[model samples]
Structures are given as structure tokens and as C-alpha cells.
Target chain A: MKELIVLSGKGGTGKTTIVAALAALMPDKVMADCDVDAADLHLVLNPQIRESHRFLSGIKAKVDEDACNSCGKCLKACHFKAIRIKRTARIDELACEGCGVCIHICPTKAISAKENDCGAWHISDTSYGRIVHAQLDIGEENSGKLVSLVKMQVRKQAEAQKARYILIDGPPGIGCPVIASLSGTTLALMVTEPTMSGLHDLKRIAGLTAHFKIPFCVCINKYDLNPEISGQIETWCREQHANLLGKIPFDPLVVESLVAGKSISEYDSPASDAISAIWQKLQLAFKE
Target chain B: MQIAIASGKGGTGKTTVAISLALVADKPVRLMDCDVEEPNCHLFLRPDHMESQTMYVTVPEIDLAKCDFCGKCRDICAFKAISVFGKNIMTFPELCHSCMGCFLVCPNEAIKEGKREIGVISQGSINEIETLSGTLRVGEAMSPPLIKKLRDMTSDAMLTIIDAPPGTSCPVIAATKGADFTILVTESTPFGLNDLKLAAKLMEKLGQKFGIVINKAGIGDGSVEKWCAETGYPLLLSIPFDRKLAEAYSNGIPIIKAAPELIPAFKRLLEEVTQ
Candidate 1:
């Protein structure tokens, strides 16, 4: 099966809008939203959850006050500064990395590591196909782990259904979560706009994809907003030997459709036409 | 006082609001770009005479000569960054959380402290406003450590503005936590409202005082403003959707620079938040 992941180094560049459009266009595909921290694909697809599961990934350290000796060793050993001297030693859950170093250093064995429930994942049925998405709890860490879980679940669903494609909606930035979504994907479609920030971030993410030896293509969203920068982007794409997919014009209907909980493909607009053309080219790339 | 301009969704004008606020502040301010993965503040601020410093994160370096295959280090690691197979032992620097668990657990004292170059922190200034930013090395998985390093480098300016990375996860928390107040920038769309709720929930959990700024206000619906009213999160400012502003932003120009009339609004915003 071919896996296509949509990524944008900069956020709010219409990555979800494009992914949702592809979900409407592609017939045999399972969708996964790897933007676990700020998942938005579901806002358009409106998936009905089939199965829900709690994600228990890392551990958090807790200090038992009764067993604690006020030696302050645990406080001093914590690199995260999670441990503080409160009448006895106290561990701040937010600051704790679950490293268990305090547990090892405690003279009285007061500190213990317990598994943390970082978030929840769900398998759902969308009009397009099966989808796997997740929500990382507020103020929680280990978002990359939750993203991997979602990807693995969606891949399994795709294999079971014998689907031809798995379209993933990736989070913004070139950090841990983005890496988790991009690793080992068949193709990556980077959605960017015509702004300097967009071009700057596009270069950074392209460097990341190239570092992993992953073949990627670029598509400029709202190219009409700045035609000059759009031309500049196309020239850069050509110089870098990167595939320049079709560009979508600035259409207000894109937002109207989103507000009405529909994909641009389901609506009539120039952006919709551009996206359909991009989908056709993507299918060709998948076959190659 | 320190103010962090953040958004759960990307491209919601966090950097634009951050630079504008810093420029309009009455006193000297320090603008910190904590979005290490893809920092964009430098694109607009254009600080002069940039001074750079390499940032590093700690990882365990095992001494093979003194090492025995006890597997203690591997077992204690929560991130599973280290593995012991028969006579072989390996450490994946990318997976390591730098908790120093292996260094503490090694019975033979074989684990030594090592450093990995993750990114660079640079300092420069635009007149009275000093600028600081962190740029992560490409392919680096972690960003919180670099963000933390940048926060630690904050000077004692009367007003400090942080342009936090997009998302409500670790990096966002690292940049936003401990600030006096946070300004959550978002648009007026379904996706924007959804992510803004998540970001607002995070701030509440952290017990951070925060307000909202609705950007691109005229394009989408009024749900964002309605939600703010219902949740009692003060709606501080609204930047209407304008082609001229969009064109200016496309060319790496700050909003205040593009439209000088917005300066008074930003000044009032600074006053309101600082009060």
C-alpha cells in the first residue's frame, strides 16, 4: 500500500483543508491525523468513533511523603527541577520527565515511578473510510509517542481493509511529532503559502525530509495572495529538483465550506479545481 | 513582566502579534522566539549584529572498557534510548530524554555524561528591543530543551515577549509556562476555534492568566468570539482580514509597519495585559 502524508512546516497553511479534500477524492484509503496535539482533520471529516483506547506511554515520578527523609538528595538530583522541598520532598508532575533518577537517588526509597495516561486514541468510521486519530491531554508530554500509536493503528486498519492508500495529516514544525509522522512514508506532500515565513519554513522541512531520504513535493496554497513570492517558490522548487504540484488560488469559499463542515472538494470553487488536479498528479506519483 | 504569544494552530499570527507588541511597548522589551524548530521572528524583526551560541543537551556516553552487560542502564531508561543485547550495548541519542537515569544506574560507573548539539541560540537587537531566538538543528526530534535554554537566557527586561511554537504540547508548555500572562492568537474558523479551545484548556490547567486575540476576524464565522465570551476569556483585540495586511505579511513586513494605525491598538493591548 502507498502511504501519503500531508505536512506543513508552518501551521494554518491549509494542511487539513487539503487532507480533507483528498479524503473526499480518494476512494480506497484509511485516514490518520498525526497532529495529535492540535488535531483538526476530524473537524471536517466528522468521524464517528468506533473504538477508543487510553494511551499509557511514559511514567511520572511521585514522592511518598511518609517514606521520605528530608535529606534533599532527590531535590538536588532532579535535572528537571521537579522535586522541591515542601515540608518533605515533593514532585511537580508537570516538570517531571519521569526519568526515575529521583527514585534511584532517594535514600529512603520515597520516590516511585508510575505509568502516566498521556492521552486517548480512537478508531472511527468516516464517509471516506476508516480513520485513526488521537488527543493528547492538556499539559501532557510525549506527543510523539501518541502520534506513532495513531499511525500504527491506521496502518493496521489499512492493511486489514486492503486499502490502496493511507492519507495522514501531520502536525506543524520539524520536531518529534513531525518526525514520527514522516518516517517511512511513501510520499510527503508539503503544503505551503506564498509568504516569506512559508518559504522559510518550507526550506527547513524540506531539509528534514531530505535528511531522511524521503521523496517530497511542494504545493503552494493561496498562491494568488502573493504572486511574486509564488513565482519565487516555483523557481526554488525547480532549482532543488523538487516536484512543483499545482497551486490553489485564494478562495473565500474554502473557509465557508469549513464553517459548514465540508471539504473544498464537496464545494464549488477554484481551490476545489486546483486540489482535484493535484490529486490526479499525486496518484501518478504513487504509481511511480 | 513576561508575555507569551501562542496559538494551538499554526499560522494564526503569533509571530506577527509578538513583533508588533514588542515594537509598540513603552519601555525596552526583550522578544524571544521560542519556536526553535522553525523560528520566523528573525524574518521580520531583522535584528542587527547577531551573536550566536551553540546549545547542547546531555546524553549518556558508555565506556566500553569499564562496561559490563548488566542491562541496568537499559532497564532504568524510561525512553528506551539504550538497549543491551548479549555483549553489545547501544545508545540512541535521538530517543534519549537526558534524564541521567543511566548515569545514575550504571553499577560500574561506565556511563559518562555526553553532549549533543541540538540547536543554536542567537541574541541581537532592534533599537531598544533585544531579540533572542533558537533554531533547532534539522532532523532533531526534541525541542523543549532548546526552548528551555532560550528561556533561561532571558535578560531582566521590564517587558519580555515570547513567541511560542504552535501546538499545546511540551514545547508550547515549555515556552509559555511561568509567564505573567499569555496571549492566545487564533483566527475565526472551525479549525481555529477547535485548537484555541485546546490551547485555552492547557493554559487553565497550568493556571496561567491569558486572553485572546482574534486574527483574520472577518473571513470566518463568529464562533471564536462567542466561545471566548462563554468561557469568560477576555477577547483583547481583533485584526480584521485585509488584502493589504496579507500582502504586507507576505513580504516579511510587520503588521504595525504595514499599517501604522494598529500601533495604538497594540499599545493598548500591552497596557491591558501588563496591568
Candidate 2:
């Protein structure tokens, strides 16, 4: 099985739009939305959840007031400032990093660790094929762990269905969750736009995928927006020896499809033809 | 007063609104691009950086000479970054949360703090507005610590506009916390509204007062404005969808400079934001 991840260093650069378009062209693939922090692929693909598993990866700190000896040791030991000195020691759950310093430093052992429901992972069936996605609870951390879970589910579902491709729609930013999505992927297609911020973000994410020795291709969305920068990006891609995939033009249908809960490839628009042409090239890349 | 401009979705013009607000402000303003993972405000603002500092997180370093075969440090570590096996111990610096628990509990004092360069903080100025942006090193896992370090370099400007990173996560929370008010910039689209709910819920959870700014207002349905009215959340400003505005932004021109008429609107946003 091969894993193809769609990543854009900048968010809303049409990563999901590209993924959905690719899904339309490749129907037998298993889809995984690894942008757990701000998952929006479901809005486009319309996945009906089949199974969901509660994610319990880390711990949250809890204080037992009865066992507390107001020595303030736990308060002083916490690096996250999760502890506050109320009449009883109050553990600010939101601020806790699940580091267990408070649990270890309490003289009376007033603090303990408890499993936190970080989020939930779903194995859903989309119009394209099987999809594995997740939703992170508000104000909760550990998105990297949740992403790993979603990827694992994709692999399992792919094996059960005997699918050859596992396509991942990744999150923005080169942070923990993005790193988790990069692991074990066969190829990465970075979607970017023709703007300075787009170029700036592309440089960072490109550097990252190269650091992991992952071969990547660049596809500029809305290349018509700034052809000057688009030309500059093309030059940069050539210098980096990265594959320059076909550019998709700026089309209003991309947004219309998103509003209609559909992919650009499904709509009768100019973007559909461009994206379809890009899909043919990706198919050759997948075979290689 | 510190006003933060954030968006749940990226490229919804958080930096667009932020720079425009800073440029039209009558008083001296500070524009802080706290989106260290992808600091793009500098691209638009063209700030002259006066100082640059490498920000570091102090991770635990094990001195095996003073170490016994005890697992106390490993047992106390909440992040599971340390492990003790027989007479050997291992530390994974990336996984460490830098909570200092192992240092406090190490009986043999084997654990020492060591620094790792995570990102860089640069101090610059865009005309009268002082600007600071934190750029995270490529492949770094965490961003909240670097954001904390960036906010520590705050100027005493009467108006501080922080352009927070997209998403309602730790890095974003770290940026939007303690602000006088936050302005959420979003487009009027399905994806925008979906993510806006998460950002709104986050601000409510943080107990920080915030309003909404709808960019590209004419492109999609009016559900965003309708939602704001239903929820009684203040709709601070709306920038009409204009290809010219987007093209100007792509060329790195501030909106106020590109569309001079919007100066009055941003100035009004500044007044309403501070009120």
C-alpha cells in the first residue's frame, strides 16, 4: 500500500479541495483527514461515520483536597502554572501539560493522574471510499497523537478493503500534527498559492519534508492570482529539484463546490478540468 | 490596549485586517505576529528588524556520572521523555515538556537543564508601529513555548494588534490569552463558519471578550452574519469581497493602502475594538 499526503504549510490553500478532487479520480482509496485540530475535509466529501473510538492518549492532573498539606510544593514545581492556591489547591486543567510534576512533587501525594478524553477518531464511509477522520475537543492538546490514530485507522481500513492508496488531507503549519502526518507516507504533494506568504510558508514546509527524506511535488493553486510570484515559485521548485505538478487556476467553482458539499472535480467548471489533468499526472507518480 | 486579530481558518485575512488596523490607528500601535509556525505579517508589513534573538527551551540533560540506576526521574516525568533501563537511562528531548519535574525529584541530581533553540524572535518596526514576529525552526513540534517568549518581548504601545495563528489550539490560545479583546477575521463560507464556531467557543472558554470580522463578505451565504446576530456577538467590521483587494494582498500591499476608502472602516474598527 502507498500513502499520499496532501499538505500545505499555509491553511486554506486548497489542500482539502485537492484531496477531494483526487478522491473523485481515485475512488478505491482510503481517505484520512489528519488535520485533527481544524478538520474540514468532511464538509467537502460528506463522510458518514461508521465507527468512532474515544481517544485517551494522555493524562490530566487532578488534586485531592483532603490529602493536601498546603505546603505549596506542587504549586512551585509546576512549570505550566496549572496549579493555583485557592482555599484548596486548584489544578487548572486547561493549563496542565500532563507532565505529572504536581503528582510527583506533592508532599502529601494530593495530586494524581487521570486519563483525558483528548478527542475521538472515526472510521467513516464517504462517497469516494472509506475514510478515517477525527475531531479534537476544544481547548485540548495532543493533536499529534490523534493524527497518528487516524493514520493507523486508515492503514487498517485500507488493508481490509484491499485498497492500494491511502490519501491524507493534512493540517496547516509545520507543527506536531503535521509531523505525525508525514511519517510513513510514500509521497507528499504540497499545495501552495502564488503569494509571498504562500511562498514563505512553502519554503518552511518544503524544508521539513526534505529533512525527512520524503520526495515531494509542488502544485500551485490560484497561480493566475500572481503570475510573477508563480514564476518565481516555479524557478524555486526547479532549483530545489522538486517535481512541479500542473497548476490549477483560480476558479470560483472551487468555492461553489465547497459550499455545495462537493469537490471541484464533481462540478462542471474550469477548475474541474485543471484538477482532472493534475490527477492524471498524480496517477503516473503513484505508479512510479 | 492589546487587540488580537485571529482566524480559525488560515488565509482568511487575519494579517490583512491586523496590518490595516495598525496602519490606520491614530495612536502608536504594536503589531505582533504570534503565528510563529508561519509568520506572514512581516511579508506584508516590511518591518525593519532591529534585534533578533534565538529563543530556547531548557530541556533536561542527564549527567550519568552522578546517576544511580534509580528510576525516580523517569517515574516523575509526565511526558515520558525519560526512561531508565538497568544502569542506562535515555532522554528524548523532543518529547520533553520541560516541566522540571525530573530535576526536582532526582535524588542524585543527575538531571540538569539544557537549552534547545526552538525558534527566533525578531524586534522590528513598521513606521510608528513596533513589530515583533516569532519564527519557529523547521521541524519543531511545539509552538506555545516560543509564543510565550515572543509575548514576553511586548512593547508598551497603547494599541497592540496580535495576529494569532490559525486554529483553536495551544499556540493560538497562547497568543490570544490576556488580550483586551480579540477580533476574529473569517470569510463568509461554510468552512469559515465551521471553524469560526470553534474559535468563538475557545474565546468564550478563555473568558476573553471577542467580536467577528467578516472578510470576503459577498462571496458566500450570509450565515456568518446571521449567526453573529443570533448569538448576540458583536460584528465589528466587514470587508466586501473584491478581487482587487485579493490581488493587492497577493502583491503585499496593505488593504488600507490598496483600497483607500476602507481607511474610514478600519479606523472605525479600531475605535469599536477599543471601546
Instruction: List clashing residue pairs in candidate 2.
Output: A99-B78
Q: List candidate 2 stretches off by more than 4 Å.
A: none
Question: Alpha-carbon error at B18 in model 1, in Å?
Answer: 0.2
Residue range A1-288, candidate 2, lDDT tens digits: 889999989988899899999999886789999988878899998888888889997899888889987789888888887899887789877788988877876878888889998788898888888899998988888889899888888898899889989999999999999999999899999999998989999999999998888888989999999999999999999999888888989998888888898888888787788888877888788787
Best by lDDT, which number? 1
What are the per-candidate TM-scores when only chain A is compared?
A: 0.99, 0.98
With candidate 2 superimposed using the best TM-score fit, by how many Å does residue B36's alpha carbon deviate from the native?
0.6
In model 1 chain A, which range of ten residues has the least summed lDDT? Answer: A74-83
Docking class of 1: high
DockQ of each: 0.89, 0.82
Fnat of each prediction, in sequence: 0.93, 0.79
Q: Which lDDT tens digits does candidate 2 get at residues B1-275?
A: 88998888888999999999889987567888899999998888788756888989989898989999699888877678899999889999988888888888889988888878899998888588888889999989999999988777666646788999999878888898889999999988898999999999989999999999999899877779999999999998889999889888888889778899999999899898898
